[model samples]
Target: MPAFGRTMLTHWHLDPQVAYLNHGTVGATPTRVLAVQQAFRDDMERAPARFLLRELTGTFPAPWRSESRLREAARSVAGFVGARAEDLVFVTNVTTGINAVLQSSQLGSGDEMLITDLAYGAVTMAVHAVAQRTGARVRTVSIPFPPSSSGAVVSAIRDALTDRTRLAVIDHVTAMTALVLPVAEIAEVCHARGVPVLVDGAHAPGSVDLDITDLDVDWYAANLHKWALTPRSCGFLWARPDRQADLHHPVVSWGRDKGFLAEFEQHATHDPTCALSAPAAVALLREWGWPQVRDYIHNLAWEAGRRLTARWDTRLSTPEEMIGAMVTVPLPEAAGSTDADAAALRLALLEEDRVEVQLHASAGRLWVRVSAQIYNDITDIDRLANAVRQRLVVSSVESR
Candidate 1:
């Protein structure tokens, strides 16, 4: 581990006994950020009525909904993502935000929703439901396993579109491949064709320096819990000012008519701890130099890819330029990268080596996905590589 990595690990509460490399699946909240969430939970529990009725609403005596603190937190998060506070609304996670947009949309026969083979499964399911209900079709562009360049990506999407293409749902950073898509270019193409774009950026917020406004996408949804150091269930949905009028909450509640922010803010009776602690999460990362953290993790991911590719005699799914804080490499054919094989390998790595990582069966092959966070260093990847080598060697022997 690098000296700087050692210093960063102290701030996180990850179990040292386990070599945790699956940060992309679900992020590990820093100790300080967790403490902030705990404080909010405690306040809510202290006086449920006072906190919910008076404090949360700031009503009755003052006639104001006491969401100023949460709004401020949203403002802080907006600043981090290069969005205006009014344009962003805090949601539980990216899935919910995408669902909200899809549900509000009007799809019908011959309508098309553009997506790729690399999108997250849950989001794909949501798109499916929307399509099924309205007789719309999901137009999928099969991005190459190892994309040649961002230009190829843009061209693929542009050529795939037709007059029926109503909306394009693009992944800013694909979950399976970990390839960072050229969103700004795609958005420009979609707009020129009179098609709106919804960017599923679940893994992009903290992994990359984002400017949602600059991307010019009609809608963008991201999960802060993935890489932004926010507690579980924290995410944000942003719609361009004009697009907001077309948006609606997934679950309509008492606040339906109270404008965009209010519609999503008071969805139902739920814990606000995650949303309330959002500002602290962003602030803590900022104080630690979020940009530096992003660069460090990115470098770690790239270095891990380099080492693993060299050791396993495999190639990366995409080039280093297309990757962010996570990278995926194809496992050797003899290693068995199927659904069952990937599951077995993941379990073996955890049980035999105490190494935590992610594996997915994609493109008819098994690929190992590793994530780099501040708590991780070269040593962690080194351990992971060793475990992988041992498992593959043992598997090869048994098969022979």
Candidate 2:
């Protein structure tokens, strides 16, 4: 196994001056993977027409190529997630893929789409937009923050499903709360209720051991950029064979009726280097050993949760098993509890302490979501703890 921690920062181009504990927000790509993406871009520049049309999608006959470049990259990514290449296609991000599924669905008046209160905020907006367009109702299932157990999560979703529920969207790992949900069990419950399941696995690609085939869901949308070490703006959508027929890309293009792959892969024209270079990211994962990487980060996140809660005199109500590479720790009560307060503290941490992390106000308190990566170590955690502690001391003095 390779040595992980501050030393591992050499593999990426992250600034040494700042401690970045926000990998789950927008991932940092390794220098090696960036080089690979640059090479693809260089090749495209050399022959724009041939590379984008002939090589990318194989729109024209190219004697030198047997398959399109996009398909080859898709195959590599499919293998990493334990899904067939045909079932997976790349998108700009998880939001784009989820929007495709939502737009394709045939919802109408009296229909309901089930989502949780913990779903990503942007996704919640998209669901509401669809609801407004089709006269469908959006039902939000409230899963308790800091859930007691995995069974509790499953039960919440199961109880929320009703005959009117046309589709159920679940998060494999929630964003703000940093909880790794029991998606398989939740999917099973939705299936029993005759509801199609769409999972937003934005943080699951490299954070957790993922196998799309193993989860019984109609659609799975995730980001390779966040945890998978891919370049920014790369994500994928996997659909069951039966579900593919009704799926459509969010943007209508020439590949409208060809097939699912054609619809998504040939959607207008944009930068394809990110998706084409996905294999390089997967290669790096294999080089480092996936199990070793996951173990180190997960352990780091678990320890951070324990240490921070102890320092703040708070409790980590969420079980360790529900944590992946990111853990949300409650701030000291001295820290103000409001959206504005959360933003101010987050900015203060970045500007004054040189630390970057995700923070949010939830359930009338402020919580920090710390993302543990190979480049982070205990010292980074300690830095954040001290920074917050100092703020609390200052606040106490000011109150007098």
Best candidate according to TM-score: 2
Per-residue CA lDDT of model 2 for 58-145, tens digit only, reads 7887789988999999999999998999999999999999999999999999999999999999999999999999999999999888
> What TM-score, computed on C-alpha atoms, does each candidate reach?
0.95, 0.99
TM-score, candidate 2, is 0.99
Report the lDDT tens digits of candidate 1 across residue range 131-202: 999999999999887799988999999999999999999999988778889999999998899999999999
Candidate 2 clashes between residue pairs 3 or more apart in a chain or in different chains:
none
Candidate 1 clash pair list: 57-65, 57-66, 58-66
lDDT (CA) for every model shown? 0.87, 0.94
lDDT of 2: 0.94
